[model samples]
Target: MKKTKIIEIKGLCVRYNNISILKDIDLDIEEGAFLAIIGPNGAGKSTLIKAILGLIKGYKGQIRIMGTPLSSFKDWDMIGYVPQKAAHIDRIFPITAYEVVGLGLKRGIRGNNAARYINNVLSRVGMEGYADKKVYNMSGGEQQKIFIAKAIVNNPRILFLDEPTTGVDIKAQDAFYELLKSLNIEGMTIVMVTHDIAIVNKYVRQVACLNKTLIFHGDHDEFCSSQNAIELLMGEHHLIAHRH
Candidate 1:
């Protein structure tokens, strides 16, 4: 079986106030890929995802999504994103999980069918009984689940998550990754940015290391076996560990 490249980038560079954040980077994301982007803070991991998703503008390069240039691409519903710090969503504001997921529903889907779809998405994320639960009252992990449900309720082909498990408990992180794994198994492409190197090997099919530029891009097995890649990650001060 062969996978098609759904995302293609060439000479991608991003800058702010004359300061370069990323430079001359090229990346291709195939359909159904589970890729992990890892780097130190401010290494442009989030910027890269934002750039690819067309959230940030004025970058020097070409990006094509689903074979259409990003400048001409308009099918946003095909892409989903969970931004960093989403776990800390306004604890003081009262909003139910069902309403949260509804935010992602397409304008055309409504009435009973929309209601059932939202509930089904909630169940898929293991937040089934939480459809009516207040996000402010739920645990950090549970709130994260609601956000994921919102991201996926649109039935996007590829999902992007930035630091999805930050500030989550270990137990919750395990469950969260398991949910992501199941989603990937069910044929959803996922691109995630994480500071956790352990997760790079634990769940990702591809590993891309970044630092103002692409330092490495390869399969997880190659990353684990290459001393140069290991040393490069060590320079970033990320703990390197092998998963059994």
Candidate 2:
């Protein structure tokens, strides 16, 4: 069966001070897909995501989310975002997990059941037991999970993450990916900007390589074998052998 395109972009372009950040980008992300956006530093990977989220505007192009034009898309709750390393958050701030997740709730979720719903979201990321603990006391991986819970608490249809695992311990990265995999299985499409090409092959269903333009976008198998991928990745990196 053919999948529906959850996100569609055409002629996407972004500029800063007359310098092109992204140019003529065209891409489509299917429903329920776990897509990894990879590129070198300063290659406009983050800019592309920000543009799609409508966080950074003044660009030229068409962007549609769930079949509606971004400019007309009023259902912001359907989209979840976990920025790079959860940078917007103060790592040492004294805040509980429950409170963090609560901050993401839609305006309608209030009164009696709101607290229960917040706990339920925390449980989704295996942080139910630590809801009372201060976020600053948790490890980097644990903090990441808390932020993820915040993003998902609203039950977003699509989740966008920017370098989510940057500060996480190497050993815990696998577990973190598994959590994201579970969310994808439950029908939340995921689009992540990452530098870890190795994990891209292991966890994500699709890959999009960007370097100020759409370099490549396709299944991992095709990406691994495509001449475009080889040429673009040449001298920069190599796709690691897929591990079971």
Candidate 3:
């Protein structure tokens, strides 16, 4: 049997002040699949993510989340998002890691249950003992893990991460990817926007190479084999690898 598509985008286009940012992009992401979107800066990679998240306006296209039209989809809790690391958070907010994760809980969770849930996710991210530590007192890797724990505290079906490993240490990056892969294996669909092409290829099952458009979308092996993939990555961006 074929897998179900969790996300669908067709004829998608986004423009900013008359300048095209994403042009006629099309993509299909299956349930439980791990997909990585890669491209250089200003390549509209983030724009495409915003469009799928329904954060972009005046776009020309159709987007469906879990087979429902984007505009009509109201199951926000089914999807989770972790934006660029610490983009909207203050390191010195004085909030504990447990408190940060607790904020994403949906209504109705009792205090005891909420704390258990928070600790469970923190443990999943290998921060089991740091629950009481202040957010600012933690290292960058520790902080990123807490942020990820916050995003998944509610048990979302699909998780979207943008530059998730930005400030993480090299060792933590491996552990982080392992954590993501383990989650994917346990049936959580992951869509990540990353610049680390080489690292992503080692984990994600699919790849979507974007540069103001959908240049390539396919399985990891095919993406690694395609000459177009190398050309597109090497053509304008030195950030991506020439070979997987």
What are the TM-scores, per candidate, against the unseen true structure?
0.95, 0.94, 0.93
lDDT of 3 by residue, 76-165 (tens): 878888887553456557898988888878778977898889889999999999999888887888888988998898889999999999
Residue range 133-181, candidate 2, lDDT tens digits: 8888788888898898889888899999999998888777888899889
Clash number for each model: 0, 0, 0
Which ranges of candidate 1 are over 4 A from the true structure? Answer: 235-239, 242-244
Candidate 3 Cα deviation (angstroms), residue 166:
1.0
- List the candidates ranked by lDDT, beginning with the highest: 1, 2, 3
Estimate the overall C-alpha local distance difference test score of candidate 3.
0.87
Q: What TM-score does model 1 achieve against the real structure?
A: 0.95
